[model samples]
Target chain A: MNSTDQNAPLLEVRNLSKHFGAVRALNDFSMAVRPGEVVALAGDNGAGKTTLIKAISGVFQPTGGEILLGGQPVAFATPQEAREKGIETIYQDLALADNLSIGANIFLGREPMRKAFGFLPVLDRKAMAEAARETMKRLDFHVSRMNAPVSNFSGGQRQAVAIGRAVYWDAQILIMDEPTAALGVPEQRKVISLIHQLKAQGRGVIFISHNLQDIFAVSDRIVVLRRGVQAGERKISETNHDEVVKLMVGG
Target chain B: MTSTSPAQPAEKHVAPQADHGDPATSLIGRIAEGRAWLFLAGLIICFEIWSRVAFGATFVLNPFNLQSIAIFAVAPLLLATGQTFVIISGGIDLSLGFIMGLAAVIAAHATNMAGAAIPLPLAMLAGILAAVIVAGVPGVINGLLISRLRVPPFIGTLGMFGVARGVAFLLAGGTTVPVRNSWFALLGNGRFYGVPYLVLIAAVFVIVMHYLLSQTRFGQHNYAIGANVQAARRAGIDIRGHILRLYVLSAMCAGLGGALYAARFTAGAAQAGEPLLLDSVAAVVIGGASLFGGSGTILGTVAGALVIAVIQYGLVFVNVEPFWQFIAVGVVIIISVLIDQAQRRFSGGRQDE
Candidate 1:
């Protein structure tokens, strides 16, 4: 059976809880995503899957919990902080600026800067274009023009651009929320393979999805969340689709 | 590493027809596609022809009339540039006109204070500074209300429209404040080697703001925020702060425009900038900047402002009643909007992929 290594998990959440007034969105939920692992986060609607992922990615701060990154306790007051710490999240809609150029979108907030006036800083377009080109070439990502708007790219190309952005920053832990939900069958398959490629690179990935088939095809470990709590954790080799389905639906 | 390239995903079987390699063909395509250039060129040509045939060419740019055209054009151009930022950022300021009026009043007061103790130059600086701050603070309030209090920009700025105008009147007691300094008069009427100082100042702002919109990270973020605010926030942009600054810029520009107008007339009346709000908006809208926001160019807006001036001046040059100028501008705004809607439908369909 597949088992988690004794080594520290890349990200460990201890009794994480988030309460929206009386909603109690997430209650004492805890999970771990480890290096070189594809941890499938399977949960039905309102199962706190979104809350959990958002908290981890710093979109929402858990009301009660301690999060350790690489065994070092960290607090992310903003997504930028989490990103600066080498953790990236691909939001459900890709969160890309549709009208901006690919290079501009990839390097949106953390643009490379040059000194324009003694100490004042301005965007270093040359350096940014060069970096974007080099990164795309290395990652084998095909964007027709670095200057073209992201809106022109297809659904699959947009996803790849999102992935390229995550990889460009050399994020250690990748959190993808329903990556293939809006994509077609062929695009879905492409994303699954991309997940495998990230795994081969020894990076940890937390894959959130509603599709049980996708969860089984790629995950090394499965973490099913139910009503804001961790209902079960399994080794994919030791679990079956029916059992995971029951766990997800709270049987 | 898995022999799977993320760039050429399996579903992406088609690539867009590549850009034409020929520079001349590509340039022609871009100009045609841009639409704004064509509309502007057409307006200029039509006006040139109308003036040449109906009236003597001198009516268009005679020695005395050139100054008037330069004078009337500068105010709308500055206000429209600021409004371009407002619209592209997905907001509108109904208070800009009144904000200008208030700034003019304050500037007039400061100019009158110039000869005593304060040197004339220092007094002008104080006047400009006073006007800018008075005008800019309402922008801050507008931003804070919209960002922190969750007030809609339209309502917030609408409230500011009344507040700024009321306060301007309260300060002035509903009267014009006149200045005694000829130096301030020189600012309004002074010529630097035959070029109006006002046009020179407005031109500088045009170049600077153009660079700001087209070349900076801040400019990119402005476009992004208006494009998809949620996406912008997710990308870790400080949306509230950036928007606040844009409003400040908008107000500062309006204030500058008003103060200059007051200097030219040597008096600050509470209603001095009454035409500012509508005129600036018309220029921005006619410039092809989307009222729905997220897209605009400074040069296009400048052209739009010039179109308004051309129509107004051209009507007078051709001996048409001056009131027809308003009707013409109203017609242009409608046509501009029609063009914008049509272009959005047209260009958005180009990527058949």
Candidate 2:
């Protein structure tokens, strides 16, 4: 793994808080992801992992706190704004349009256009197909039917396509929610390695997962949350599954 | 939930092989998607055989029969064109029928009023433009109800259906609005070189619709939203705005259909599109578009519409009861949906939990 000590943080959330009526969904949560590093967020159900990621990804306005990108404080009005600022959140089972091709999925909202007959604008299908081909290839993933709908692809392949989308748009920070949760063993392994490739490319990743093995396998640091608060943070090399589980369900 | 295994990178470099599996299955898949064309071809052959056996004449080769069928298809086809977009976006516009009727009434009134002081051709154009624009009003309401207010599509459009129908009838004073413009009548009834002007207009309109659905970003996004709206929203699509535009576009299509109807019969009836709602939706379904959304083509709907026209005209040509048209269309729609279901099961079998 490349040493991220010399690199500055790509994304930082300081004292973030979110509340829905009387319920504190997330409170006083702070984290930083540096270039070429993967930070795994570990928590049990209702421990505010989703809340934190949603707040960071612009799905929800934080009740209080600040998010900084490249040393500049930023507030995103919507997820689209976050994406434009290079923050992409790939929600589990909610990322790919099953009936669309990989290229179409990659260029969903922002489609490439070229003039036909020098006036009429049309979708640049050739450009989309070419980008899909190159993006998947760049991720070390291959699917033969580049134009086929993604419903034909397995779970892991779909995950790769989602990652390919992030890569194609040059997203600097990727927050993946349970990326491998729906995949088989081999497919899960494939997704882990895709994360490895992202880390190698100097992109920051916040991998939220319940699986300790997946978190430990690709992440450099792990942050465990309990009851909407940070329970513990540890280096992967220093912590084991038992200790992380203890942090998740504190006495 | 608690399975722990060391992650290995051995399988990382290996590409997942395409698992479409077997030539026969793929052949079935292809057949399923293009079944609308097959149905149209099969219907033609059947009609041709029936014509030869019953009247010793060829049904397909008769220019009069072909022309009549094309004319018969225009109104329904136009409505289906709009329905195709709505259905592909995972919604149905039930108000399109009354919307067409409303447009017809508006077109008749507008044309007659304009014809009193203007050139006939200009008056006809003004009528059509008015009908289409007025038709978009209900569409905007429908869009607001469905997209902004979060009303279910079926209920929302159905509500518009009643409202449009009542308004159209009220505007016409419960009678058909007779058009007085000679040019409007000529456009509806006249033809060039053995082809009806109505057919030509519809053909041009259909071609444009095909382009809009197949070649534009709006079309692609329609498919995306239908297939998985959450994914589309997350991908940064403006769902509410798109829905608003979509409904407006649909209403405008229906409006055009109504104006054409007013031209064809030289009168705009409040019920001009009352019977066509079912036919339009059937054409879309028969064309291979799923009502559940996301997988249809305009070309398919064309074939579907032609199939209905042929069924209606052919049944009449063969001396079948007029009521048989309803039964026959219903059967074909069911069969198309069955084919769609079988195809989905065949291909979507890989979507495992």
Which candidate comes out best when scored by TM-score? 2
Each model's DockQ score: 0.33, 0.44
lDDT of 1: 0.80
lDDT of 2: 0.91
lDDT for position B265 in model 2: 95
Q: Model 2 over residues B82-189: C-alpha lDDT tens digits? A: 999999999999999999999999999999999999999999999999999999999999999999999999999999999999999999999999999999999999
lDDT by residue for model 1 (B1-353), tens: 32221232233323223322345544543553355556666766776677788765755456556677778888788788888998998899888989999999999887777657688877887887888888998889888888888788899999999999999999888899997777788889999888889888898989889888877878888888878898888777899899889889999998898888888898888898788689899988887788877888898888788878877877887788999999999998898788777655655555434
Model 2 misplacement above 4 A: A1-6, B1-15, B19-23, B351-353
lDDT of 2 at B135: 99
The candidate that wins on lDDT is 2
Which pairs clash inside model 2?
none
How much DockQ does model 2 earn? 0.44
Candidate 2 residue-wise lDDT, A1-251, digit = tens:
12334466889999999999999999998999987788999999999999999899888899998999987899988988999999998889857889999999999999999999999999999899999999998888877777888888888888999999999999989999999998888888889989988877778899999999899888989999999999999999898999999999996
